[model samples]
Target: MRKIAIAVSLSIFIAFLIATAFLIHPFGYPPSEMDDYIIENTQSETGANNAVTAVVFDYRGFDTLGEATILFTAVTGVVMLFRAKKKREK
Candidate 1:
């Protein structure tokens, strides 16, 4: 009974995940006017070929810092969860 319930729940969760992935917009709506202005200005001001890359890696480096921090936290959590317990000897 427990196994059957778990299997049903997992199947439902997987189906929901697939439905959401296909139904939802991944990149979301089009960028706003201000976003376009920034891209244009960044290209002209900085003379960078790829405006988006320049903005992400140079103009908005702080956001990248936050993303790195989140990645580090996730890795730490996984390590802690899988770490072996120390044995106590008499």
Candidate 2:
């Protein structure tokens, strides 16, 4: 009974994932208007020489910060785990 329930749940999850993947846009073909606008305005707006850097650091600053925070948290967690393992060995 439990095994049957687990199998059904796993199948449903796999089907949902496959459906979601199919719904995603094809690679390298993002919405163009925003991309064009960014490319046109990035240097004037942010004074950045490189448009990619301007987008990452200026237009999407908060997103970059969030990613940095996540990376820091992950590194801290790994360090703590290593310390705990070292202590356990003593």
**Top TM-score prediction, candidate number:** 2
Query: Candidate 2: deviation at residue 12, Å?
Result: 9.2
List ranges where model 2 is wrong by over 4 Å: 1-30
How well is each residue in 14-65 modelled by candidate 1, as lDDT tens digits?
Answer: 9999998887766678547877887678867778888888878888899999
Worst 10 residues of 1 by lDDT: 81-90
Residue 80, model 1: lDDT of 72
lDDT by residue (1-90, candidate 2, tens digit) is 999999999999999999988888887776799889999998789888899999899889999999999999999999999999999999
Let me know the TM-score candidate 1 reaches against the reference structure. 0.49
TM-score of each: 0.49, 0.67
Model 1, runs deviating above 4 Å: 1-31, 85-90
Candidate 2 all-Cα RMSD: 3.1
Query: For model 2, how many clashes?
Result: 0
